[model samples]
Target: MSYELKSAGALSGGTCCYAGSRLPVRGPKRDLDSPYIAFLGGTEVFGRFVKTPLSDVSESLLKMPCVNFAGVNAGLDTFASDQALQSVARSSEISVLQLLGAQNISNRYYRVHPRRNDRFLQAQPPLKELFPEVDYTEFHFNKHLLSSLQARSEERFAEVRRHLQEVWITRMQEVITTLEGRVLMLWVRYDLKGSAAFNHEPVLVDRSMVSALLGSTMGLVEVDVATAGIEGDFDGMIMGELDFPAAQHMLGPKEHARIGCALAEKLQGLI
Candidate 1:
C-alpha cells in the first residue's frame, strides 16, 4: 500500500518564530516553554513533502514535543551561525541532529550561501588555484561545482573532499558543544547498501566518518531505509512539479514512521 498524496495547500501550516530569528520555521507550533526535543538537520529533518516529519512522529510516540529546527539544504554552519536557534536548542531537554552532507558547509576551499547552504558563493584562493581553468562564477550550487571539479580530476578533488570532511567534523563538534543536555546524532540514508559513491552528492559522510566524528558519544543511531520500500509504501507522497527536483529523493511517511520508531526506542533511557 502507498500513501495518498495531499495537495500543497492542504499541508500549509503557519510559521512560528524561534526566539526572534528572522528565518521562518515550519510549524503546527508547539509550546516552547514546556520540555521538548529539538530536531536539527537538512531537508529530511524539515520534512519537505511529507505531512509528518520524523520529529513529529517521534514526538507522538514519546508523548512529548519535538521542535523541528531544520531548513532546506541546512548545513552545520547554518545552525552554528544562528545564535537564536542555538539558544532554543540549548533549552531543549535533548536534541536529535541529522547528519547532513559535508559539501554544503563552508571550508577553506569554498564558501556556501549562509541561509541557502547549497548555493555556491565564491571559490576561495585554494579552490580557485585548483581549478584555474574553470570559471567559478558559472556555478550555482556546491554539488554541481564539486561534480565538475571531480570530473576534471579525481586526484585533485580528493583534496577538496578531505577539507570538507575535516570542516564537517570540526563544525559538528562545535554545534554539539554549544548545545546543552544530551544530543543524539542521527544519520538517515536512502538505502541499506552503505554510503553512496564519491561521485554521488548525497551520503557524503559515510558510516566510518560518523563513527570517527562522534566517538564514544554512544548517541548515534543510523537508519538506512530501503529505497524500493519507500517508493512502494508511499504513493504520490513526493512533492509536486513546483518543488525542486531533489525533493523527489526525500523520505516519505512510512520512512518517517520507521525513523520515529527507532528514535523512540533510542531515547527510552535518555528522556
Candidate 2:
C-alpha cells in the first residue's frame, strides 16, 4: 500500500439535516433526492481531521452520492436510536456501516448519552453489581471506565467484555434490520491491541464479532491499517494544532485514499 499525504489544512464544512431529522451531519450536504449511498459510523466516518473522508473519495471514484451521517464519538446506539437518521439510511440505495466499539452503547451494565455514545452517563445496577468495590460515579467516558475496570481485575473485566460484545452483536443486527438497503459493513482495524485492550479503536470487538454480522449484511470489507504501519504513525492530516494529538491516531489522507478505494471497489461490484 502507498503511504502519502494528499493535503493538510483546516476543514470548512456545511452542516446537513433531513426532514424530521435533527442530527448534525458533516457537509456540504448532498441532494438526497438522487440515488446515493449513506455512510454511517463514528469518528472515522466523520473524518474528524481529514479533509476528504473516505465517503467523499468513494463518491468521486464511483460517480455516486454518498451521504455522511457519521458523528464524532458516535456508537451503534447513536444511529440505532435515531428515527430520522434511520429513515434516511433506509431510503438510501446502499448503506455503509462502520464497525464501532461495543463499549460506547448502553446495556445492562451502563447507560450512555443517546447521540454521543462515547460519554458515559451512569452505571447500571449490573455494572455496579459486578464491580461493587469500585465507584462508577468517577467516570465520564466509556473507554476510561472500561480501562479502569480492567485494571481493577482482569477476571472480573472479562464478564463486562462478554456483555458488551453480546450487546454489540444484538444491536448491530437490529440496526441492519432497519437499514432496508444493500448494507456493506466496513471493518477498519488500524492496529493490533497492546496491553490496554479496551483502549483500542473499536474497543472490545474482534474480527469474529464483526464477521458474525456478515450474515445480516450484504458484505464486509476489512482494512488492516496496522499491517501498513499507518495506524498511529500517519501524516498529511488536516487539523488545528490543538486537535493534532487526537488526529494523530486517525487515518491520514493517504490512508483515507486507500480505504476509499477499497470501499469503492466493493460498492462498485454491488452496483
Candidate 3:
C-alpha cells in the first residue's frame, strides 16, 4: 500500500499537514542485529507530497531497519522539543540528519504563541516581533512575514538569526554527540538548480555552522537531485512521476524511488 496523504482540512494534531503514510517502524519487526537507521528533518524528510517515503528507499536498499522521524512543518525548535529526536537518540544505530533551509528558524517562533513559547524563545521579544503580522487564530509560522522582517531590518534580523542558528547548531551537536553510532548528514531540499524549475529559486546552502558541528565526526552525503536533471513523463519540479495532487512537497514517485535508491547506496557504503 502507498503512504497516506493528509491534507489541510484533515486532523493535524497541532502539526503541519503533509503527505506520507504512517508506516510501522521497521526496527521492532526486524532482528536485534538489524542496524537501526533514523530519518530526520521536516516534511521533506517525511516525504511530504511524495507518494513513497525516503524510509521506504532506505529499507529497500540497505536492508537495515529504518524509522522516519520527520515531522510536518518541523523546524529546529520543533525537532528539539519533539519526541522523535529522543526516539532517535534512544532507538537508532545511525541517523540521517537532513538539515532544511534557514526559514525554519523563523518558524520556530512564529508558529507557536507566547503562552506556548519555550523559555529560550520567550526571552527574546524582538525576535517574536519579526512575525507580528501573523494571525495566531490557527497558528502558522509566517515565512513571508519573517522574510519581510529580514528584508526590513537586516541588522536586527542578523542578530536574531544568529541566535536561532546557534540554537539549531547546538541542539544538533547535542544529538550527534550523544548518538551511540554513525550519523550521516543528509542535506535535502527542492530543486535549486537550472533556471528555477516551476518557480523554484536557487538557494545557497550556508554550511559553515554545519561544518563546525560535524568537525570530522559525521559522514556527509549531499543529494542534489533537484539539479540532477531527471526529466519525468510529466513536467514539474521533480519529474512528473510523483503521485501528488499538489507539487509542494518533493520529487514525484519515480524521483522518490531514485532518491531511495541513492540513499540506500550511500548507506550501504557506510555500513
Assess every candidate by TM-score: 0.88, 0.90, 0.65
| lDDT assessment of candidate 1 | 0.76
TM-score-superior candidate, 1 or 3: 1
lDDT of 2 by residue, 101-125 (tens): 8989999989999988999999888
Q: Which one is best on lDDT? A: 2
Worst 10 residues of 1 by lDDT: 192-201
lDDT of 1 by residue, 65-104 (tens): 8889887677777887889988988898888988878998
Error of 2 at 91 (Å): 0.8
Candidate 2 stretches greater than 4 Å from native: 1-10, 192-195, 226-236
Clashing pairs in 3: 4-21, 242-252, 242-253
How much lDDT does each candidate structure score? 0.76, 0.80, 0.52
Which candidate would rank higher by TM-score, 2 or 3? Answer: 2
Local lDDT at 61 for model 3: 73
Candidate 3 deviant stretches above 4 angstroms: 1-35, 83-85, 105-123, 128-139, 191-205, 227-245
lDDT of 2 at 218: 90
Model 3, 155-228: lDDT tens per residue?
86676567666666766676666554367887655553334212231122356876876663457766655522
The TM-score ranking, best first, is 2, 1, 3
Question: Candidate 3 has what TM-score?
Answer: 0.65
TM-score of 1: 0.88
